[model samples]
Target: MTNPTSPRRHLPTSPFRTAAPPPAKRFAVGDRVSHDEFGLGRAISVEGDGTIAVLVDFGSRQERITAPFAKLFLL
Candidate 1:
């Protein structure tokens, strides 16, 4: 059980979970990527620091996806 105040609690007894969270995902212009729902596409442009949102060209249509990018993945 956990609360909104602290979603993840790290214990000293656990060695594996002690490491910091994974680094943020980064995408460059023209970087090929795939989305769970958007099929496949190339990154058209990156908004802000590239972590806030990403504009992707998914063939038939373009969509703006924001973080945390749960479905977005680099190809």
Candidate 2:
């Protein structure tokens, strides 16, 4: 059996080689954005350097979206 504490073999085609996560989404005030559920909206404000949440104003309502904005996309 292979030792669990041993160094991992680096395979050229291994998916684990790249262990970095994707870049976070950044939005500035007044920037236009689209959401999966909230639809289109304008960025009103951001909190915690945008790592906490983002306030967006939709025509019908407003929402505070959090980090790792999967449904939120830049327009």
Candidate 3:
């Protein structure tokens, strides 16, 4: 039995809890990248010391993805 007033603890293997956010992804100009929804692209411009946003050219369009990019990955 557990104390009703006690704060619940997160299990080490708990899938519902996130121990830590994934590391921030960094990109540089001319880098190749793939996006979950945008397909393959090439980095055109980077801003804010590579911590703010990255401008990428996806051939058909360009996107400005902000920091902590979840769907963007370097190739």
Best-fitting candidate, measured by TM-score? 1
Better candidate number, 2 or 3, judged by TM-score? 2
The TM-scores, one per candidate, come to: 0.75, 0.71, 0.69
- lDDT for model 2: 0.88
Q: 1-75, model 3: which lDDT tens digit per residue?
A: 889999678888988965675666778999999999999999999998677899999999999999788889999
Tens-digit per-residue lDDT, 5-44, candidate 2: 9977678988676566788788888889999998999999
Candidate 2 backbone overlaps, count:
0
Q: Compute the lDDT for candidate 3.
A: 0.89
> After superposing candidate 2, which stretches have Cα over 4 Å from the reference?
1-16
RMSD of 1: 4.7
lDDT of candidates 1 onward, in order: 0.90, 0.88, 0.89
- Which 10-residue window in model 2 sums to the lowest lDDT? 15-24
Instruction: Assess candidate 2 and give its TM-score to the true structure.
Output: 0.71
Q: Indicate the worst ten consecutive residues by lDDT in candidate 1.
A: 1-10
Candidates sorted by TM-score, best first:
1, 2, 3
